[model samples]
Target chain A: MKMHNFNSGPSILPQEVLNQAAEAVLNFNNIGLSLLEIGHRTSWFQDVLDESRSLIKELMQLGEEHEALYLHGGATTQFMQVPMNLLDDGETAAYCDNGIWGSKAIKEAKLFGNVNVVASSKDKNHTYINKGFEIPATSKYLHYTTNNTVEGTQWHALPETNVPLVADMSSDIFSRNMPFAKHSLIYAGAQKNMGAAGVTLVVVKKDVLGKIKRAIPPIMDYRIHIENGSLLNTPPVFAVYVSLLTLRWIKKEGGLAEMEKRAKERAEYLYNALDSLPLFVPTVNKEDRSFMNAVFVMQRPELEQPFLDECKKNGMVGVKGHRSVGGLRVSMYNAMPMDSVKAFVELMTEFNNKNL
Target chain B: MKMHNFNSGPSILPQEVLNQAAEAVLNFNNIGLSLLEIGHRTSWFQDVLDESRSLIKELMQLGEEHEALYLHGGATTQFMQVPMNLLDDGETAAYCDNGIWGSKAIKEAKLFGNVNVVASSKDKNHTYINKGFEIPATSKYLHYTTNNTVEGTQWHALPETNVPLVADMSSDIFSRNMPFAKHSLIYAGAQKNMGAAGVTLVVVKKDVLGKIKRAIPPIMDYRIHIENGSLLNTPPVFAVYVSLLTLRWIKKEGGLAEMEKRAKERAEYLYNALDSLPLFVPTVNKEDRSFMNAVFVMQRPELEQPFLDECKKNGMVGVKGHRSVGGLRVSMYNAMPMDSVKAFVELMTEFNNKNL
Candidate 1:
């Protein structure tokens, strides 16, 4: 059965990318060596890194002042690295406590320097994006999670700030067109919209670094990584290659414009269906809802498990919500087909009608 | 033609492991989704992490005191993480400077604490591992690289020390039977003898951690990783899965005892052939020579390029040495076949005859 995959992260990748990745593992470019066996410094893998970095910049339409790096350790590592490199001890950085990822980033930043949470939606269970927050001019940077995967909220507009914006666009990067160059630093874990779980994509403006007074560890320092071209050490080669394939796919499919179109189509259909169905209630403010992940609950809480079981029987998987707060979360990444969204809606309609 | 792989880290893995890895990427366990598309928290992936951890402890024959963690970033990350977790500010730690990896380790450790350079083989270009290095009793830990991949020297015996032992076994881990319980922590990048390139295997004794006074980042802290069972954040899912497959292959083929046996056989054959060939010169001391990577150079340096060209024409690849030091290095990890060694020796003989 060709099931509809809705896993939050390590989520859906284009079918062609998966095919090429599998073939590369067996015989990389017919060189008779597994992709896993090749050295990172070799020309073959270097081409991969080069193309990936180039594609990232080209897609974002960023210039030479900004650099793209495919680094090991996920976005969680960046949570600390961002502070260590840009914010020195006694310096303050502004953060928005939107949800889990935002809160975690603030916590890690606090360890390295003073963090002032300028805005928070915590009082509302992070169901909506906090706007009109005052940005402190003394802050070295203003940090926020552009998309909250758990809370099912996304910032549709870039937060207006001149404090050198740093955004964790882990769940929404490359899925829609945005003012990418406006931010000084943008990082996203590859598993969600970019590629796989091992590699992280970081685009940073070179001028923002090296101003901190603290001595940063070489591995944790962004300037050192950029100087070495993200090859300061052995990177996740397979992950980067997969990401390159994905970047190529995005280019072929007409770039971010096409991706955003598909995202809107999917989100509108699901949201429209949820609004019509009396048995279901969509979580989060409608305007602040995420285009990638849709979180919802049943009016009759007892029907939740049965509805999930039915969805499973009908070839739906990974529709279950996050364990931290469970209801139902249907993640529709860039690769998710509209047909799957339609099928899920049909299933929801049938279940709601039968239950009512 | 099937090339004989000798690339230094990100080296060859078993043929069967590659096949299985490729298959999983297409359809993991017939789950109708690519392994790259599933969430790391899924039971499917949790099982992989669990088995890999169990296999690591079982192979090392360690007790409950030690915990095995599969982490992101390679051994280079550990160079600083080891010191950050173990050594406090102004505290002294003993380190041996044998070759590239050890020297890098020493450089990173200096940022975290006072480092005591107990032994160095720099006078001889790291051709031999230093023995009888005086480890300070008051030091927080004694750190060393067990195998110098670039210099082709390996420590056959553990250093005698009362301080906790931290070993970077990135090149030689799982290829030999060591006193595993004696070391406070053992970390290896899974590119050589373990599995692939992205994930690192960290086996740490629980007792040595949490004693340091500095505030450690959650991602860099060993205790946090172990407590979360290496699921502190989304790990390199595909990398860990490949490692699990490789670990299973190792166990199925008779564990570390059999791996060591094969390694010794392959090393001895290549080393003996190098010793006999009048045109070739083995670089390292006979006793300190690494069983994993054998570095050598042509007596007539000009013939080196011709020999390498001949090797390439005859289905040999990655025989080139490290870029830092220009000489040939043949890396024979656990998965390297005895047949490859025999063929390489035969080629060396043919090249010597032609050149002489």
Candidate 2:
């Protein structure tokens, strides 16, 4: 059986990237040393660092005002560090509580300053992005999740706000064209549409920082990272190297425009199947449907087991839904080929035909 | 010429471990997916996580009273998070300002609570550990760096303090035996003597946490990590897997005792040559020398460039001194072979005969 991997985050990467990364691990750039063995300070690894940072700027078309930092600790750490560096005591920031990560980020933000729940999807089982509320002019920044990995919802268009924007594009970064100029900061954990876990990419507009009065911990300070060029400490070298290889793959495959096209095609095919199939139904609002993850459930709840069994029989892995939103979720990241999505739809169709 | 890697970290890894890790990057545990692709929650990776945690406990002889967590982020993150979880506001903790990392940790700890600098090596440019100072009885914990990476000094014996002891063992962990019950907590970045960069090994006595009154951020909370088995969020899977492979290598090569023996053997060989060879002098106090990193300076400043050139010609990399300490440093990590050190000594001997 041909396995179709859909493990969110620590998920699929381009085959070429995998092969190249594997080779580097054995002998980095033919230096007769494993990439794992080389120090980040070495010329071989410095090239990787410089290249990874530069590629992000090129892909997003970011300018001199923006600096890209490849940091360790994943996006989870960023939830706190972002506010720690940006939000001062008695200051206010607004956030949308649309999903698990969003709610968690809101919690961390409150620890630093007053965080306004400007919008929320909690009333609707987190199936939609809450866009009904207003962003306060006094808010230091308005934070939003560009894509919710668990809820299968994405903000196709960001809110037009005067307040500085900070977006966590963890699950959908590099999968589509980003309005790089609109946001003050865009951060992502390098797992979806990037590389492996352990690294976070924080692209920040330089001017938005240093206004807060708090003395930020040097490790967590974005300004220090911009000053030090993200070599604050020995970074997640293997993860960053893998990310660089992934960026190379993305550029080779026609960059974010092509990625967006493929992602849309995959989601459309899978989402259409979910709606039309006898025993299956799409879970989220169609307008807010995510290109990264398509979550659905069996209309006839009894068929859920058969659907899962059929998926397993076909070697479809990680299609299992998050425990919070139980049913099914198929992550179609940038690296997920159209053929894999087609195979997934076929499995769903066959399972529905037998069970319905 | 075969290269000799002595980079402090993100440094040399076991060759067999490197080969295995590289193979895993392509296909993990025969599951047709890259280790980079698998979800940390899946049984495949759950096994890796369980095995990694178990190996640490087994090697350290830790029992149920202690729990080991494999976390994302490097040791620098640990500098702040350690105090965030351990020290409450106004509660004092004792720390030794022994080196750069130590000074950094002290700075972060002070942000969370009152930090007493009970001892320091700064007066001597961090070449020696100040042993005469006493830990305050009211201090919640006593923290120290096990090795001064910048200055090439090691604490051969941990300070016997009535206060709870916590160690930052980033550079020397897994290379020798640890006093499992003597410390309240032990943490290490996995880049040295373990694996690649990005993962942190936090071994904590279960009871030591939760004593503080302040609400520690969930991500920074040691108790939460213990409760969730360090899966509070996505972990650095590749780094952790590599760590497991390295641990396996360590066990195969006779574990900590063998590592300690090899380290002694390498240090003795290099230190002997440093003393006997012309135009070279050891920089640090002989009593405080680190078995892992040896720092030495040219007796004659004019010979520095010629010596460095000779080293490069013989394929010695990362032997140049840190800019902060303008002297050569040879990091003889556990993965470093005795043969490499022998080769380095030969290069030194020949260079001295030709120049000095």
Best by DockQ: 1
State which docking tier applies to candidate 2.
medium
Docking class of 1: high
The weakest ten consecutive residues by lDDT in model 2 chain A span A127-136
The models' CA-based lDDT, in order, is: 0.92, 0.88
> Who wins the lDDT comparison?
1
Residue A305 displacement (Å), model 1: 0.7
The local lDDT score (0 to 100) that residue A332 gets in candidate 1 is: 97
Off by over 4 Å in 2: none
All-Cα superposition RMSD per candidate: 0.8, 1.3
Q: Any residue pairs clashing in model 2, and if so which?
A: none
Proportion of native contacts kept per candidate = 0.88, 0.76
> How far does residue B271 in candidate 1 sit from its true spot (Å)?
0.7
The 10-residue segment with the lowest total lDDT in model 2 chain B: B174-183
TM-score per model (chain B) = 0.99, 0.98
lDDT of 2: 0.88
